[model samples]
Target: MQGAVGELRTLSEGDVAAAWALEAAGYPPEEAASLAKLQYRQREAGELFLGHFVDDQLIGFVCGTRSLEDHLTEESMDVHEPTGTTICIHSVCVDGGLYQKVLQNSSKTNSDRTHSSKWALCETEGCGDPVDGQ
Candidate 1:
């Protein structure tokens, strides 16, 4: 891949447009969250919204919310506590420029902020499918 790695950081409300556009490009209508919805999410748990930027452009992201439930539901998307044991990941969207093989080659991802050790990778896995180019 020609692309170089970007900064991995927590996204704030200022990045909403980029986040919304990225979501539109990365996910189908049935799956993509609306700007209002995204804004609400940011209000709920902005700390959980993470993004990858290349040249200051959003390329990918992983979004989630802290919860008490061991399992996930549609309601999980609407509710997010600032502190919780369970983190329900809602989406993982990557840029169209990158390929699956390249992503597979990538490992040991990191974020600038510190999180709790008690928190596990609560992967609310989406339908198993390859990332599609826009």
Candidate 2:
């Protein structure tokens, strides 16, 4: 699925490899997640992982999971909870040197979280929406 600004699509089963490449490139070896971990995140909570593409080529991504945990941890890197209230951002990697390794910030309580919450800004003419599996 292509968006108005390049493509703003969520990562799918077939996109694990590409997502892994981005992770490895943006994160240190110790900080980077294993392929299996990445796969689980995509399978379990992929809706939170959005990819950016130029001409259908993936150049960056924003990924995370739902969790009650307040802070980023090695364990959080491998887990996702669907019913979790807090959005634990795992990573945000942009090709233009704007790579945020892990969402190191502690979680905050939110009773009114919605999809409209701006995560990644899709830079294109009138295209700020992100595409999920829907």
Q: Which candidate wins on lDDT? A: 1
Quality of model 2 by C-alpha lDDT: 0.58
lDDT of 1 by residue, 1-134 (tens): 24576676777889877888877887778778889878877778777677777788777776766666554545667788676555555666777665343233222232224243223242334322222111
Q: Write the per-residue lDDT of candidate 2 for residues 14-130, one digit (tens) a residue.
A: 877887888798778877767888888888887777676767767777677765544444455567767654455666666655344222211111112233232322222232232
Native RMSD of candidate 1 (Å)? 6.4
Task: Give every collision pair in model 2.
Answer: none
C-alpha positional error of residue 69 in candidate 1 after TM-score superposition, expressed in Å:
0.5
TM-score of every prediction relative to native: 0.71, 0.66
Residue 82 Cα positional deviation in candidate 1, in Å, after optimal superposition: 2.0
